[model samples]
Target chain A: MEGDIASIGAGLAAIGSGIAAIGVGNVAGNYLAGALRNPSAAASQTATLFIGLAFAEALGIFSFLVALLLKFA
Target chain B: MATDTHETVVSACLDSHGGAIGMPQLCGEWIPHQIFWLLVALAATFFVMSRIALPRIAAVLAERSGTITNDLAAAEELKNKAAEAEAAYDKALVDARAQAQQIVAEAKAEIQAELDVELAKADAQIAEKAAESEKAIAEIRDGAVKSVTDVAKATTKELVAAMGGTADAKTITAAVTARMKG
Candidate 1:
């Protein structure tokens, strides 16, 4: 109760990081599904899969960064 | 007075305890500093990536694809060569078989001609032997007929003398000849 309202904003921003986790899971899960359906093509698409993971994880990192900024910037 | 004294003693952005008075990230005083460093870092990353990492990756990919294409071409060529070799082998086999058949036919013809010649020689030899045998049989029959005619003439003369009748040799011969002729 004695803390500033920015701490509340920071806590809310962390929720976005958790939401970003859902996006990352969606990307990985879809890739796995496609890979399992066509294993012969999986080897060629590994690079694309890693790129998707990086893009998904970048958003999660951004949300975590915003949370840090809100908390202690 | 307390707030003014606190702001004067400490800096505008820091508390007396050395903590930030507010969000330092949004402070106008440090915006240029952050912007300049951000640009510098981004430029450095772009230069390294564009000049080194990206070109290496592209070259590796190109080389790998080229190698795969070359290998595929080589495999195709080898397959064609194998087919040609097999065709050549089949042709050679056919030629050899034909030559063998021709040799067999030539040998058969030669053997038949030799057999025909041997058969003709044997026939000629058998015909000569048969003719000689027939001539010998005719001479023996002529000798036997002369002997029989002499024996009958002597017996007829003896019989005439026993009967006390004189029979002439010429008459007896004439009668015997007449009877023998029948």
Candidate 2:
């Protein structure tokens, strides 16, 4: 209660980081399901799976960066 | 320290309590230092990856692909060789079978010719034996006829003698022959 409105905005941005975690989990879970369905095709698609994981994690990192910026800057 | 009024004015970025008056990260004075360090880190990463890591990865990938291609080619060559060997084996088998058949046919023909020669020789021997037997049978038949005529003459002579007739040998023979003719 002693902090400014930017602290509240930082808390909301941290929520965005948590929401981004859901997106990353969805990407990984879908990839695992597809991999289990056709194991033979899974080896060829590992690069694509990694690229999806990086993209999803990068969004979460951006949300975390926004939260940090809101807190400090 | 109380005589330096310029030091108090220059330290406006900090509060009286030694805390930052505003966010230190957004200060203009630190921007150049942050950018310089950022560029240094990026250049170092680029140098390590380009000069060392990327080249090694590329070499490994190239070598692996080359080895795979060579192995595939070798397998293909071996397959062709196996096929060729099988064809040669099949051809040799066929040739051997044909040779065996020809040998069997030649042996059969030789055996048949030898059998025919033996059969002809046996047939000739049989014919010569038959001719000799026929000649012997004709001679025996002639002797039997002479014997029967002689026996009839003797029997008639004895019968005449018993009846007390004094007949001559020539007349008796003539009468026996005449009776035999009847």
Candidate 3:
């Protein structure tokens, strides 16, 4: 039963991580398009883009941690 | 005996396993995996942004900057040219003004010189006319004096001839004296 629960938690974690990744992809795609259109603003926008990517990736990281925790603890 | 003990230990371990088991978890800490994936994603994003996006953007920016600088330099050169042209025009204007003044001065001098020459000529003519008038007056006076002397001499001769016939010395003398006195 514990193993089954752990498996289920791991599966949810994967889904959550996948969803976060999708969000990051969207942000990056939009940033790229905008950068292409207005190259002058790229220097100013790079930091913001990285910050957004970091936040989205943080969520995925949290989900992965939950999966590991459920499995181990 | 060792094989029997190994089997017993394995069975014990399997029996202790939970029924809910579907997958095995490798470790208690998921942070490592999370960090690794996050790093991977960030690296990928940065790579695309730097390699693909940033270089093109920089190139575009550089081109625009170059164009702007070239335009500014051209404008500066044009401005300098215009200023030089203006300076040249001003210099020419000054030269023209000076030349005109010189011409005017020269003309005035020439007019003054002509006037002086005319005045001198008129003065000479007046002096010449005055000398001619004086000469004419002197000649007329001399002619009048000569005519008066000639008339006196002729009258004397006529009187002497008329009183000479059949007259004594005293009578002639008395008659001549009377006539002369009268």
- Clash statistics: count for each candidate: 0, 0, 4
Candidate 3: true interface contacts recovered: 0.00
Clashing pairs in 3: A1-B19, A1-B20, A4-B20, A4-B21
Name the better of 2 and 3 by lDDT. 2
Report the lDDT tens digits of candidate 1 across residue range B1-182. Answer: 34444534355566765567567777677788899999999999999999999999999999999999999999999999999999999999999999999999999999999999999999999999999998899888888887877788888888998899889999988877787787
TM-scores of chain A in all candidate models:
0.93, 0.91, 0.87
Candidate 1 wrong stretches, greater than 4 Å: A1-73, B1-30, B51-71, B104-182
For model 2, state the Cα shift of residue B159 in Å: 18
Give the DockQ (2 decimals) of all models. Answer: 0.24, 0.26, 0.06
After superposition, candidate 3 runs with Cα above 4 Å error: A1-73, B1-28, B121-182
Over A15-56, each residue of candidate 1 has an lDDT whose tens digit, in order, gives: 888888998899899989999999999999989988998998
Best by DockQ: 2
Question: Candidate 2 regions off by >4 Å?
Answer: A1-13, A21-73, B1-41, B52-86, B123-182
Find the 10 residues in a row with the least total lDDT in model 3 chain B: B11-20
> What TM-score would you give candidate 3 relative to the actual structure?
0.34
Q: Candidate 3 lDDT, tens digit per residue, B1-182?
A: 33343433232112233221222333224457778999999999999999999999999999999999999999999999999999999999999999999999999999999999999999999999999998998899878765654554454445555766344455544554565447
- Highest TM-score scorer: 2
